[model samples]
Structures are given as C-alpha cells and as structure tokens.
Target chain A: MEIIKIVSLGIVATVIIVLLKEIRPEFPMFISLLTGFAIFTMILGELSYVIETLSTLARRVNIEFAYFSTILKIIGMAYIVEFGAQISRDAGQESIAMKIELGGKVLIMVLAIPILLALMELILKILS
Target chain B: MGVVSFINSWLRDIVVLFILISIAELIMPKGNLKKYIRLVIGLLIIFTIINPFAKLFRFDFSLDKVVFNYAKPETFNSWELEEIYHNQERQIEKIYLKKIVEDLQSLIENETEYELVDGDISILKDEDNYGQIDYLVLYIREKTRNNSQGRISIEKIEPIEINRNLEKDFTEYNNDESIKALISDKYGIEKNRINIKIYKKGIGEINE
Candidate 1:
C-alpha cells in the first residue's frame, strides 16, 4: 500500500541523513530538507484523493460548500504548518521553527473561530 | 458513489473524530464551565460528522456570511491585486504614448513649424507580418510669424484664420503624390476621409 511505500521512504531518508551527518555534515541538512519537501509533496498528492472523496461525500450529503471548504482549509493549514515546522527544526533552526508554529497557531485559531461560533449558534438554536 | 459504501467510509472518520473529542473531554477538569465547553465542542463535532448540513436548519445562519467569511477577503484582495496590475498597464501605456508623441513631434518638425495639439496613430496588422500605419489623426497649430514695421517679430495669431488651412493646405496635402500613393498602397483607407488639416497657432500655443 501507499502507507508502506511512504514509511519505507521515510526510513531510507533517515538512514541516509544519519550516514551523511557523520561524513559530510553540511549535506545532511540539505538531504533531509529535500526529503521532507518531497514527502510533503507526495502527501499533497494523497490529499487530492482525500479532498476529492470528501467533496463527493459533502455533495452526496448535500452539505454547503462553504463549510466543506473551511474544513478543508483548516485541515490543509494544520498539515502544511506541521510539515514546515518539522523541516525547520530538522534544519536546526529552533527559533524559526517556533515562529512558524506560532504563526500556524494564530492562523488556525483565526480560521477555526467562525466555525466554532456557527456551531455554538446552532446548539443555542436547538436549545431555544 | 454507492450510499452504503459512502456511509461506511465516512462513519470510520466520524468514529475516529468522536474518540478524539471524547478523550479531550475526559482530560478536562470537572467543572460547570468545562461541562458547557465540552458539551458545545462535542455537539459541534457530532453535528459535523452526522450531517454538517444540519447547521443549515437555522434560518438566521448563512453559511456564506457566518462560517465562511474568510473567503470574502480573498475576492477583495484579488480585486485590489487586479487594480494594481491595471494601474501598471495604464502607466506603461502612458509612457509608450509619450514616446510616440515625441517621435511624431520630431517628424512634423522636419517638414513644417506646426506644433501638434493632440493625435493618435493606429496600426493594422495581418497574420503573416507587421502591417502598415492604418490611419493618422493629427490636430496641429500652424506657426506663423509676420514682418511688422520692417521688423521680423511675432504676430498675434488668430484662431479664426487657421481653420481656412483645410481649403488651402488640404488640397495641397492630398495632392502630394508620394503620401497619396503611400496611403492608397499601404493603409487601404478611403481617399476623401483622409482630410489632413492644419490649424493656425491659437492662444496658449507654442510659437517658433
């Protein structure tokens, strides 16, 4: 399955990074960075499948597109931010990684509030 | 597309989400505020999982206005972006037109002492190659100096006098063999409409 292939690729990348870290210290960062980017892009390809299925399901369930897209954006933001911060940390930029995480948290917070409010409003309506 | 399989797949995701939410609620400290927050969050998750469509039941809530207000800013930003590009395009066109006017000013200076008022040059092209100048519309001010009291000095130019250049120079302009042939051979515009008239230098015109 795709999971196995991805896991194998991750293992291979880690092994290569470790081997290169002892030999050419500079090369390891670049290797790891590129591997992370490649993996992120590969995961993005898989995300398209998930998105397609979700959109089809949303359509089948007759859900409003706005909500579905908001959910998708939130999900995408989480994954992309997590991936970016991990890559930054792997490159030994702890400060930069922290800032990325901070920005991602702010963005996720901003994006999520509206949905939360809408849901609260819905619950209130039901209670009333 | 089958309803049964579709429900099965979505059900798995819902179960996972429910478990995660449940764990989150369990970890929270037991209190009135916690209870309300958990209930609200849990209900939201459950509603989203069961049928996100259920939120549409509330008549006051518009998905577009309430839940997806983020989408509006993108469109607004895009319009601002487009306006920036349009402003750039207008700036470029103004610069190009200024250059063309400078070229025309020099071209007219070679033959006559007429300063151009306003003009436009249109070009028509074919698929194969660069085409010819289709038509040139030029409004010019005729520079006329008079010898008053045996002294060659600038005369007060009248706007009324220069309009007669159509009768005087218009025939001479059209009768010019080289330009007439060039216009007929290249531009393919009708003969009579090509009325190239020169107006006398009026007030506020540059005098040479």
Candidate 2:
C-alpha cells in the first residue's frame, strides 16, 4: 500500500514536471526536488525500523558497538550526501554536485581514520 | 570443551561482522563512494580475522588502546611510574636550564661588550641545595661592529700558527670578572661557580 502511494505520487509529480518544462523550465527542477523529498521522508520511517533491527541484532551478537555505530554513521552520511548531490545535479549544477560528493568523501574519511589507525597499529604489533 | 566454545564464539563474531557489512552495503547509496565504503569494510573484516590470531600470539592488540589512549588513563607499575616521573622531571629541569641560559646570554650581551656564544649550567640535585645553580660555564667573544653587516665572504684562508703565549691573552680579557660579578649579583649564584671563557675566534675574525 505504501509502495502504491509512492508510485502514484511519482507518476503525478512526473506529469506536472513534464507540463511545466516548456512554460517554466526552472519550475520542473523544484517539482522534482519536492517529489524527491516526499519520497525520502516516506522511506525514512521504514529505514529507521531496519536500522533499529540491525542494532538489536548487533547487540545480540555482542559485536563491538563502536564499529556498528561507525558503519551506521557512514551509511547515513552516504545517504544524505547522495540526496544533496542528486538535488544539485537536478538543478543542473554539476560542479556543486561534485563538491558535495567530495565533502562527503572527506567526512567519511575522517570517521574512518580511527579504525584505519587501529588496523595499522595492530599490523605493527604483529610485525614487531 | 573450551576450544569448542572459543571457535564457536569466533565463528559467530565473524559471521555477525559479515552480515553487518552486507547490510551496510545493501543500504549504502550507489555511486563513486561505494568502493571506498567497501574498502573500509574489507579492512574491518581483515582486522576482525587477524585479531584472534594476534591474541593467540600474545601480542598486545587492542583497538581500544589505539583509539582511546587519550580518553583513558592506563595504570602503571611503580617502576614505570618512577620512570615517567623522572622523565618529566628531567624535561622540566632541561627547559628551566635552557631558559636560564637564554636569559643570562641576553643579560651578558646587553650589559657588556662580550657576546655569549654558548653556555651551560649544572643544578644542584642534592636534598639541601636542590635546584640551585652549582656550576655555570659561558663561552664568550668580543662583539664586533660587523654583526649588523649580513654575510661577509672570507677572501683567503689563514695558515695555522701555534701560539704558546696563551695566558697573556687569557688574562688580558679579564673583563670576564665584571661579567661574573654581574651574574652573581643578579642571579644570586656564587661568583666562584660562574666560569667565563674567551673564545679564540671572535666575530671580527670571522667577518674579516
């Protein structure tokens, strides 16, 4: 039922975007961006449920919570960056989209540094 | 058996890690970033696999130690504690001595016609006279006017000559007495403890 609603919303938005493309080309970008946001919000509720279940599973297994949380953060960052980049691309700002992607990559690298350092230290310890 | 339980736990950890990574990849947005995330996940998997073997080999392999060294305080045995204390104390003393020498060098330069080239101080470490300057040795030379002129090229190399008349030159630069008195008066160090030596190579000699 939720998928049907999302599909119907997409179809209606597509029609409006197509109608506005000739008269006011800029309006089409806004319409598409609005539709994207609507679909994102709709799926976000389901995504939270999945994340909660994954975290509980991680807890049940007694896995290190740090790695689990870090992975979650990276996934969240990726999704947010993807959303921003796509929006920029839709607005025909290719450079802005690329910059957004670069920023996201740098942030992800910052988050991953600790894990990388730990791995390096481990390797060194083994070697020595 | 303990071995069965150990293997069971290890297998469970690896499987859980694999499943978690798979879920991450599944949820991850597809783009150029996917490969990087995959690389990090691969590293995590490698770390998890190698971690047990590292432990088996009795290596001190803990991610917490690497990541949280600042956040966490580690307990040390008495010997290590003493070593750390002595190291820190020595560092403080070294900085203190350096500052004192710099101050004395500037003082000598400002108050006298001599330029201090190098100096060292020995602090009393005994219980009664702790931290008192026990010995101070300063290598000094006469300041020349050419100090303002940047770099001067040496036109010719002078041949070395053995001069046996050293005491005359040494006693002639007894302007060091006034310098010793000034330091002793200002720093409260004993005049006998302060030793000033005239350097043979003055700034004038190098500039010429």
Across the candidates, what are chain A's individual TM-scores?
Answer: 0.78, 0.93
**Root-mean-square deviation of candidate 1:** 18.8
Cα lDDT tens digits, model 2, B1-208, are: 9778878888998998888878888898898788768767877788878887787778876675565442223322468658978999999987888788778878988999887656667889999988889998776777756435677645342222222233333322455689999999998998888877776656346446
State the lDDT at A7 in candidate 1.
87
lDDT of each: 0.57, 0.78
Give the range of the ten consecutive residues with the poorest summed lDDT in model 1 chain A.
Answer: A61-70
Kindly report the docking quality category of candidate 1: incorrect
Q: Which has the greatest lDDT? A: 2
Candidate 1, B-chain TM: 0.36
DockQ of 2: 0.21
Candidate 1 similarity to native, TM-score? 0.44
The residue pairs that clash in candidate 2, if any, are none
Q: What's each prediction's TM-score?
A: 0.44, 0.57
